[model samples]
Target: MPRARPPLVTVADVRAALWSLVSTAAGLGVAIALVDGVHATNPWSVLLAALVVGVGDALLRAPLRRLARAGGAVGALVLGLGAQVLVVWAALTFLPGITSTSWTAVLAVLVVAGVVMACGHWVLGARDNAYVVGDLLRRARRAAGLPRAALRTAAGPDGAGDDGSGPAADERPAGVLVVMLDGVARPTLEHALQAGLAPTLDRWLGSGSHRLESWWARVPCTTPASTLGLLHGTTDAVPAFRWWSRRLGRMVVTNRPADAAAVERGASDGRGLLADGGVAVSTMFSGDAPTSLLVMSRASEGLGPGQLFVRFFASPFVLVRAVAGTVGETLKELYQGWQQVVRGVRPRVSRRGWYPVLRAVTNVLLRDLNTALVAEQLVRGAPVVCVDLVDYDEIAHHAGPLRPEALRALEGLDRVLGLWEEIARGAPRRYRVVVVSDHGQSLGDTFEQVVGRSFGDEVRRLLRERPPARDVAPRGAASRRGRSDGEAWGPANTALHALRPGRAGEGRVLVGPDRDVPPGPPAEGASATPPAAQPEVAVIGSGNLGMVWFCREPRRLGAAEVALRWPALVPGLLASPAVGLVVVHDDEGPVAHGPGGTHHLASGLVSGRDPLAGYGSRARADLVRVAGLEDAGDLVVVSAVGPLGRVHALEELVGSHGGLGGAQCEALLLYPDDLVVPDDERDDVDGTRMLVGAEAVHRRLVGWLAQLGLREGA
Candidate 1:
């Protein structure tokens, strides 16, 4: 069959095309006037150059986009600039009245093109900006008596029942709005409310219409794991924020798109919490929603209605505001970091890297974008909308969880929530606001700072003290050998190795047929033989949680095997003052050991004092379940807690999660009082029961929607 010709361009298309041409011309004219030592005799010449450049760009856009997708962000940038430079050269050659022909002119054209493209993208490509413009248009239409009702009547039955009223008084709420404040633990938020840092939350807490409740997050309380579980109702195989997979022979970082997608796929049961005309914004996973924005798992897919870049750029005001805000926020973050340093803030990490930029993006750009998108969703009467704001989380990671900076972020988030609440009140459908969090953060000094050495370093020290054998080599020697063989073993790789099953405390050393043998001098009166390659060990730390793996073995090793291989390994780890608890798998089941006593996970029996005494009642069960995962490390270690309720993180984070200690496990949920919780659900330990995990939270939310008559039933 012959392919049909593309549809003829409409008047609107022509208008848009002309707008692009004019915008490009104006941008180029401005650039020419601004560039030093470059003169444009006639503005008409700049317009001619813009016409040439614009036509070229229009012709090349598809190919450029394709190249960008193929080459990634950096490669696409370079390729796009080079292509623009060529286009400018061609324009200069063909255009009349263009006197400038120097490299400086070409550079000016490049800058102009960049500015125009950036502004255009910021307005038209951004979803947040689109919503802003769309909202304004909607309001204008409403003001002119072209209300949503008229549009809905014309569109058909889908818009019929949205008259902002129901048959009965009980049937008030038409939808559910869930706001997830990432990393704001229950205790932290409560303190913020009391301290007046979170005025909106404080008001909500005092309001009789809402009820505040605290819940527990399951083990490995990271965003990916918690969000997947909450959205899809399961987080079966997710080990941690980052974990080594023997099946894949690589480390899987959940924040990465591919890894997040994999995790989403594994956890999903076809029907997600937001499957009923839901919208997910700024979340790690999409909850299988049809519409998603800034969701890591769905990032590879094309931009959805939730993306605000295009819409933002389309509105000059929003675009300029964002650009100005980004500049101001960048400086603000730098000043804040500097202030922290000068103030001698305790338990602070160096926020000198990409942190300042990331902070600005999350706090200013992302926060505003999310607020706009959520308001848009509410106005459009989305059945269920979930948005994740992570400003406090990012700030808390560098500063302490309750630090003034983090508190300020919380205050900002509370204001966004207040805006959402106000928008919901005016929305086409009544919305029951639900506020929750994925997980909480714990504040303390890091293990390396407290112990004066890294976890991997201590493991290496223990390995070096032992005699070298065919299966065991010094960690330093192994690392050097691995580097020489082109298989470099860095700290991260060493952590992965330490979590595997093999000879205990082995550093990452590659041993194969092609491995290079280091030359060495003969011992006294004996011929020298190159040292046997030691198996690599990885000692990875996520927050206070640490995993020790022996990489030489293909399968997870039992504690007995580890003990037999390296007798001093367990003792050395236990002796470390920073290590509070250690759990290792045995032939029977997992066992938890601590300075206080040992707990047998299988029977929940304690040999001496309980190892999980101060952690919580759920700690033993949570640990046992995580230890049973197939990809769990050979040995799991948790940092000790001090008398003042501080836990040491394995990573250099001041505030962290992914282990049981402090306020990390405690999370919060604030929902309207009208939402009913069934007795059966209240008793449900990990499911529809009270909030035990993200899945339970998901269930409760669905139930609330059902009660509000948003869905058919729970």
Candidate 2:
């Protein structure tokens, strides 16, 4: 039998094709204006050139898209540029009016064309374009009987809801979706919205459906701690991002998969916010979610083919768009870094090295991945979804938190939020979107820059210096003077010697044990020097917060013992104007010593200006509470706030956190106005009233889920 004639293209297809053509033509016109050698001469000539280029693009679109998809984003960008160059060459060779000087000029034209195309895509809604393609691909796959199964199902405590069947579209329960924009402060976001950098967020706030409220992050405000608290409703023993774990016998970096898993185990109580069939994307912890993507806690497990990856890679153009987008973003980061240098923007850290590439990956590739995965979850009718985007946090770390580059990151996130809102409207279940941040960042110069030495170096100097006269006196005499000279004579003294082996003035203080430590029994006990006192003093910096551990000691020492061993240590730290508050375990309990001030946490007594005064009301409580954690440092050092609110970071970060001061603790939460806050109690901090702690934020989110009848009981 003869084959039936192919069906005619629909009106919608024709309209889409025309729109694509117009967009390409407009982009070509822009390229023509930008390239030096290319001369349009007149509006007619420009129009003619655009038409030729657009026709050529349309003719080769299918093959080019296939090639681009295979090559990924970077490859596609290169291919597109090459193709554009060839088209321009053909146009200049055949057209009468269009002219170019040389091949170099053609290359420039192609570059400009690529940039224009990218800009056009961004302006005309890039995510929307991807969404349309993804939706079509999904529908096509479903129709082919290759339906993608939902990765997880909601199960009540008794497993009553464990059936594989999904809720019908209309019968689907209301869901809550939380988007955590890491490291964005409430004030910073407010300024961005006022400055028109974040129009989408501004619109959301103005729509009356959402309300913007500021809350306080717990002490040692950081991603790992705040995220853990937000997800599991407890920060607990997570004192800092990286710390000396006595139990692990090594430093624990929170981003490391093993350490993250361990930390989550310590903090999670099995009933995380996403415990019941929720989805977590790009988060530090999985929140005990059944479906998780790029979660640090589960990163050790080999990633498998899943719905998110399937949906993300379904469209050939998505990968190409991501690559092209990353390239453009990388160029922008370089330009922004250069501009900062030219403008002599102070308090800015070096933006060289792999940072530009990292920023591109974060702002483009990772962002696209998160957005696609979240969209997939929404489509699959997840009960609750939580996604953390680190684009702003990564940028704000090197660049000042409020710099243009960081603000641009915020704008990009706002665009993603808009996309999610659009997707949620047609989702199987009604979703109430909430935007929150793990913690805010404080901008400042690093302590090393201001003090001419790192916190570790200074501490080493104190350890190397000869003990005070009282410390060197006879043990009985020292005891009479209320000093325990034991630290100077015991294993701590051996650690000091190990730390400064080549005499006090010759070698730098040992930050950690020598990497070349002899293997296997130290060569038959060849004068084994007490295992060389590995990490005599562990000084880990979490933003502006500094944690110092006297590692040689078997157990944590109090302030008196520390003073007796290294008398100049506390004095030296306090001498530096950059040092803010130093909290240590004293005989009386945890005592916070600030510049010319001291506060006894146990008694709630202040000797000088209340050290925790401007740090917020919960600051004292939070600091004391964190100090008591088993993993907390022997002495916790917080950077002093300058007159302009800048805090000196312990690390080499310009924008710092992990301690109180300024916007570091001031996080924001944007939720639907109809959602009820769990506590709603005002925390008065130095006369400023606000919500305190990520734990409260967690409760509020859980309450929202409960209110939607998604939980076991409302």
Candidate 3:
């Protein structure tokens, strides 16, 4: 037999535990209720988050107490905060389906809540040793001024070079260099320019080869949508990514964004939908296809846009982590391999700038940049080279886009861009550079703002109604009556058996709920009548994705449109202060409109040229000419308002794009009048045209190439 163990806890322990529980319960209830009162979330969602927190807290109490005694109060606080961060981070990462906002925000909220609870221990003096430790750590951190410290510059690899002799340039350029900027909204750029924050662009414009005007952006205004427009030069309405699977004929929404592997996994899982005996082709995922990806015939022939997207990139997360781990190792190895490459470059530059926070993410960017840079160097390139930087979007999500830290990150990115420009300038006469952002940044906590307050009382009440029961033994019979009762309505057996059947014939109908069934003889001539119809009860609202009436009608606009158009709903919901954007699905697509900062609408255009100018008119004509009869856009609207939208106080996000009337919808055209390129010469060009602008420029470029006698593929 096992030895008997001493009692783990005593009477005093029990009392403390009980007090903690009660205090915690009360505090959590008040917090959640207040959050609800502020219209943070509907009653049910608030209750759920509270329950999770409560259970999580209970499970952690023992460790917390032990840590308090060992670490001192200050140490205990740090322990608690650390524990909370880990727990919340794991929950958000592993079970993202349950996460309403980004993991960063969830971790923040969890820490704040845990800290507030630990303060109770301080006031109660439940654990003095731990409190002291926590205080010490706090003071130490404050004294160190850790939060505001500037990051150090990172060292480059010994052989990493800017002289165009690096491995990135191993592959020769293929004449034409096409760079696609995924979310560049013209209005957003104009707003940034008008704000006077970017002076570099003004100079670029003054250099010529610039055309800024109303260029139609991709429909749905997503990365995929915009990218497709640039690649295929058409808006086919075939979504690049969607929750609905035609093969499975079902809706399968994911809590997390799908990477390249996930797309293939989905295809494999749905293999049952494939046509007879054909093995899955490897070439499909290898970027071997040549023609446009939008044509139905090509899509059916195993050349799909889905496969193409995956072929060009690896999983983003994996790339980031690998890059981070290799940095220290790579620098050491490179320094040993090449002395000249390390001559002026610092060994620490690899560890500096955005490298520290983005240690895990910088690898993919390195590969992407290296590939573009190297390819262009080895092969002679065309006149224009467009470079698309998507890191801004990713950085903004983890750290607020415009936050000082994020700006610092952007500065690092700008430096990298400068590096690329420096390399291209080596062959300046042969290349022209254009750099841009897809859209602007907005700030806000994603989750709490959406789920904090929503749903109607009427909807909730309707869902809670119970159905009535039927079937019982006959009553008032001698065989069924109890000893003390004379012909009682119920029997004296089990609780359920005790009930008796009501009157037959006329009483069966029960015209009103208040009316009782009339008593009747149990003979052959009588039959029970049916009950009258019950009135419909009002419904109470329950949960939503941030919209005012989500649960009431989640199916109002269908699912696919919602998934594509309203990505913010999943990441921007909050359960406090009732701040967030509302996404509503429509026949056209998911339409978002709310008070908080989010890109709920398409942006406007920005142009130095008149709307009625020559090329501008021609561009308009081309748009009308290219649209097919079946999938043609019904109406095109230009928002007179600039890309910058109104910013509300009490919200973190300052701006948004994609609304109906905004500057984000506009395009910047920089085609010099003297250099009108022919359409035939613009084969390497990507993205849709501002007909007048693009075609004119194309004609001009073609003419220059003709003067040089360069052929399409030569």
Candidate 4:
């Protein structure tokens, strides 16, 4: 038996396996570099990563194989891939920023690395192929799909090939600008893109640009989701509004992490983050006090970036909605303030005009974004300049989209764009500019009027259900039952219950839990239970209704259950013909259910269009189909091209985007003949359509660039 024992696997075998794995990874990486001659990492660093991967594979091969055999080969691939990625990541992690200059050098280095990796794979590793290598390349390409050239239509149909026939990509253009008009759907934007509003855009369309359709926006039409998607170039791990109220007990509009932090803090302190105490209670009625002052005064000093932003915008309307409960609180404040004034006590000046307040908020937001843009330009100095205007959106929300106010806002944004173009033109550089929108808007009524339901009624009903609810009190418990009657003592749980009978002396029977006094015998002298009280419900119209219920306390049920309420609330609202969508919220922000409720965020970008078109699609996602850069929309609601498609309309909020409607989802991409061809057919890039505008424009641009021979300086 001993003599018949087979030879044991040796270190040489393990080494071979390790080398194969290394070669496999290297090969794939090289393939990526060759195709897209842009690397955020240096060639030396990449090589170093390759070497580390080789070493790591050698060390982990036996273990990995054993684990793979035990955990399945699929598991092994996962483990191997993870390790390889880690090695590459580690190599780049400690390094500073990366820059790329020479395409030839990059392509050559990638090729060598890829070949070595392939050899290593062949020797020691698994059965990954050139196809696998290509897959990895595709992933990288998708990640970097949003390129300045692609955005500006400078890439052409085949996508900026590195050949002597074409004009040097460097000589093609300097500043490439892309502006998105959020919520302007495909059909809506297409009409305008086809119409000659901007001469540059018109040229692109006339030349036949490659066109791509059907990229989905994330839910909810929130700016964070849309902008982040645009910046990241994909829809994975989107930044959606956190719906569950963890900290404040109820969700109005808080992001996820904030909700979690609120819950945790509430648990620790035995208090809800939403607990107003004195300040929150005071500001609701008259809207005078610095509502967030109390919260900020007590918060920790070293807050994170998000917390900092929240802290900056923590007003009452910005914070919690306590209209009903705060009535008493407001009375108290007025009384106190009057006493102070009579006694010659004066507080500081107030910035409280409604219009001025709106203006101030917009101004601050504009200033912040502008500062960020300027700083980025100064630091990066990239050839492309993308500007997103929010003026149209701001005015559209406050004033109807079609109103003069909204138009004024659009004009202002145009002025800003004009100034930007002027600056670009004056500079010693050439730039190509493109503008787009996700959807268009409708005009008619307000969100409340269109939906025919009162959010106030819903709030009251919810409070009545739990009379101990802060907003409602039970019927006549105090008057019917004297303070001395302990047996009859009970809180007036709801406003309806507050009118009920209490004890022996109590006259008429009323709605409440316990009797404070004996109810008078029924009219016929028979002891009978009184009829249940019914709270009056306000009129609910044909349009939709949205309810945002904030929780009063932080609990596990608070987060999960409150968010779940959106499902129950939306169906009823959607029953109306005019009510197509409903978005509910609690402490976590917007809690939505149904196919239309929970979705990706919409873009906050503004488009360059006629005033009518620009304001209509303010908050919708901006669906961008350009390659090399991320599209600006998260959710796109496409509406019909014409007025017959009109459903629900409002004044302050007549239209919004975030759904996959005809108008909000579809958009236009106009490019120049020197840049693209507008083609309707979708091109598969890693199984996803990577369509541009049209074929003719793409061909013309490619041909023109090739004839120019700028790569060889002909």
Consecutive 10-residue window with the lowest summed lDDT within model 4: 280-289
Worst 10 residues of 2 by lDDT: 478-487
Predicted structure 4, TM vs. truth: 0.36
TM-score, prediction 3: 0.34
- What TM-score against the true fold does each predicted structure earn? 0.70, 0.73, 0.34, 0.36
Tens-digit lDDT track for model 1 on 1-714? Answer: 322332344343455457656766676676667665345678788778877775675576556656555443334435555666777777765677665558777666555554554456557744223323334334423422333344323211111123422212123347778888888898899888888877766765564556777767888887767878778887677767655555543444554444556678777766787887888887778888888766766655533431233233323223334544566667887898799889998877666655666677677666766776677777677888998888888788778898888898888788677556545544555567788888899989877677777676677677655333432222221122111111111111222222232431221222321122221121112223321232366556667877766655677888899888877777788888888889988777999988878999998889888888877667887898888886678888888877766888776677888888888877888886666555555433324335687777878776666666665545
Which candidate leads the pack in TM-score? Answer: 2
Candidate 1 lDDT trough over 10 residues, lowest sum: 481-490
Q: Cα RMSD (Å) between model 2 and the true structure?
A: 12.5
Candidates ranked by TM-score, best first?
2, 1, 4, 3
- Of 1 and 3, the candidate ahead on lDDT is 1
User: Higher-TM-score candidate among 1 and 4?
Assistant: 1
lDDT of 3 at 204: 40
Q: Whole-model Cα lDDT per candidate? A: 0.64, 0.67, 0.29, 0.31
Of 1 and 3, which scores higher on TM-score?
1
What lDDT, from 0 to 1, does candidate 3 have?
A: 0.29
**Prediction RMSDs, each to the true structure:** 11.3, 12.5, 27.1, 26.4
CA shift at 388, candidate 3, in angstroms?
A: 3.8
Runs in model 2 deviating more than 4 A are 1-172, 465-533, 678-682
Instruction: Tell me model 2's lDDT, rounded to 2 decimals.
Output: 0.67
